[model samples]
Target: MNEKIPQQSLKGCKPEIHYPCVWQYKVIGMERQAIQAALSKKLGDAPYSLSESRTSKQGKYISLNLELTVHNEEQRLHLYSALTADPSIKLVL
Candidate 1:
């Protein structure tokens, strides 16, 4: 005898797919580790990765690239706002 699965079993079982959002910051007046620490404190436990590089031909400032898993526009905007509000952050993209 063959068994049939109930349709209700699949209800509310839709898969969730997350897309990584990237933010590039031309950060100044602070070290990369400090920025990363600040971000971690602001964004909480959300999964993220950071990469930083000093600009070519200039040792005055550095750029930080942040990769995070975001669910909606609000989250992205919030992150941008928080980063921009910091005095050490020069630019955000």
Candidate 2:
């Protein structure tokens, strides 16, 4: 799902990012409700925005764009890891 990702890093160099920034993550799953539940479990009471992206032609899968403010790279990666670890979530990008 990372099609044509932007070149943020060069080899081993990490991209510089300001702290407490809003990040966007594309979460793909089987069902809308299931995706919401999984996100709730992972995010707790944290505020976030979730919007439908698109569904497979057969309606087998759905992708949602999730936006939330991350305090640092660690928090951002932690959230990504949590989303990927959920059984209901198929992929995160």
RMSD of 1: 12.1
Question: How does model 2 fare in lDDT?
Answer: 0.95
Task: Put down candidate 2 lDDT per residue, 13-59, tens digits, no spaces.
Answer: 77789999999999999989999999999999999999999999999
- What ranges in model 2 sit over 4 Å off? 1-9
lDDT of 2 at 32: 95
In terms of lDDT, which candidate is strongest?
2
Q: Model 1 Cα displacement at 28 (Å)?
A: 5.9
The true-versus-predicted C-alpha distance at residue 91 of model 1, in Å, is 1.2
Q: 48-91 in candidate 1: lDDT tens per residue?
A: 77767565356666677777667666776787888888776667
TM-score between model 2 and native:
0.87
Consecutive 10-residue window with the lowest summed lDDT within model 2: 2-11
